[model samples]
Target: MKMAGKMDEEIDLGLAEELGVEYEPYKMSDDEVIEALRQINKEVPWEIPVSKELLPYLRPTILCEAHHPEIREEALRIVEGAETSIDAAMMIFYYMISRIKYAMEPPKTSPDALRTRKGNCFTKAGLQIALLRSVGIPGRYSFDKTLLKVIKIVVPREIFEKMPGKFTIHQSADAYHIERRKWIQCDTTFDEGLMPFPYNWNGKTDLLLLCPWWRLGHVGKSPYFPVNELLGRFKQRGFTKDFCAREIDPFTEHLRTLSIQELCKHYKRTLGRRDADSFAHILYFHFVGHFRDVHYNPLFRYDTNLEDLSDLQESGLRIFEPKYSVEKFEEWSVSGIPFEVE
Candidate 1:
């Protein structure tokens, strides 16, 4: 089901018997099974004080510094008027997707994200998890594998063709909803203007704007910062700063050529627009950062460009990999029926 310790490959569950793993059948009436599924899908109101089992998600890791004073303060400031945990989470989600600048360079840790307001998907997920944990909400990360071709809609053909990998890691943060007893997945990697999907999170549905385009396949869930493992993998694959520049610099140059209006119009046509006017205002801000700093480019913000922070990424290597004891994922049976584990 898994390949070389990477994302799981979809397989026929009936082959489990062939693989020597015993297959188990469901024992319940159709109505009972339907009721059980409804319970799984039910949206219950968020309640306070999650169980002790969720402690792993509440604690701080090197990448997710929930215990840091700065993280706590910023979290409190962001959710000042929130009455419930769900409200606080929604507030945090909006702040992350709107205020924070998406970049692939350094300052990836939660505390660093608050300091710089910039990071890639993992680091952004780190900030989200840290902020939620700071306010006593259990938070974790879910990983997926997205093909590099998915971003071809945004990136120019020349740049897309030259990019290295076939697939890359995509990540999102999860907030535990106590009443529902489930973690709601929220992908805050793309800012509001950049993403065509409506900017909304109801503390129930998954907010993955890019999933519709990326054709993402599930990897696994982790209570700890899985970026460490990713960093290690990148090192194993010989990914370096210069190599990143090879792929990134060309895209950055291309952005310089296009006007903001052109960029918006291009996005509207390829990715659809969330509003009436092309997202000119948002693209303006994006251009401001892009022009001011050569490191900034909207097209490949999802790609984690390790321009600097080699020390932090190196330090995280192998230190924060997730253990199966605390991981959660949707499971399937031989009959193709799904099951949940907590």
Candidate 2:
């Protein structure tokens, strides 16, 4: 199997080289590029998709409205009779980690995740956010750079080190605490004996939820992206999803067959840098593809008919309207990203 996979990779690279595949880096004007991405992000078409008479979750997305009746009810049940919202929130976060085993994949609908009892960092983050949004809590995706680097561990040191550098972003949940009057980072991807959950409730600082487990000294998910802390970085990271799928995987494979000096020469001429910035347009697309249901999942690639959506609609106490538009974007600058959406 290993040899076959390696041979497959070699063929892919040979095909790329024969076709004149190579990187051509250029400085993208931040304003023009970001505006284009923001437009694309907003354009993912959505509609009621079902009769307004049915369940809440059944309705299609309008940005952060990922809430569903089951998610809300379960979250409320776990936070069972908490005296304060904070306590309730804490309980819900705990329930997320305790219940879901960690895996690596793009997020799925809350019910699917709950039924399976497993998901990647993205799934974990999505689960937490669904709960938060379901119960009327305000939240958004949080993207962190320094934190994303910890994900390098998942790639295997050999393949990971061979890449230009850290491929892209890491994300988690962020929620607003009303009484505290601030946003808190809810790193639910891991469960520490303590949270090893030491965030001081000040609502300002982000508590690194599983510092010891990840790092040995600190590291990686329940699959959440940080909020717009770095906008350009967000665009940069999202843009990588497409770039690597189209360019890097085979290019990297081709590089594997070359001598050190040949690799360096190829690197400078084709990639333009010896840093993550070189293949900055790329991410290990496979890292997320194994689980992302884009092509297979109806809810993602195709809209469900009115009847099927009825089963998936929201049946909750409250329908938390999204405060932010799905179109919200910015903080990072990504160059060489074409505005094309497939």
Deviation from native of the Cα of residue 26 in model 1, angstroms: 45
TM-score, candidate 1, is 0.58
RMSD of 2: 22.4
C-alpha local distance difference test of each model: 0.54, 0.38
Give TM per candidate: 0.58, 0.40
Q: Which candidate is the best by TM-score?
A: 1
Candidate 1 Cα deviation (angstroms), residue 66: 0.5
* Model 1 lDDT tens row, 113-211: 777676667778989998887777778877777766445544556656765778877778988876567778877876543442124455556655453
Best by lDDT: 1
Q: What is candidate 2's CA lDDT for residue 245? A: 37
The CA-based lDDT of model 1 is what?
A: 0.54
lDDT of 2 by residue, 238-282 (tens): 323334335433433344454333433443443233322222111
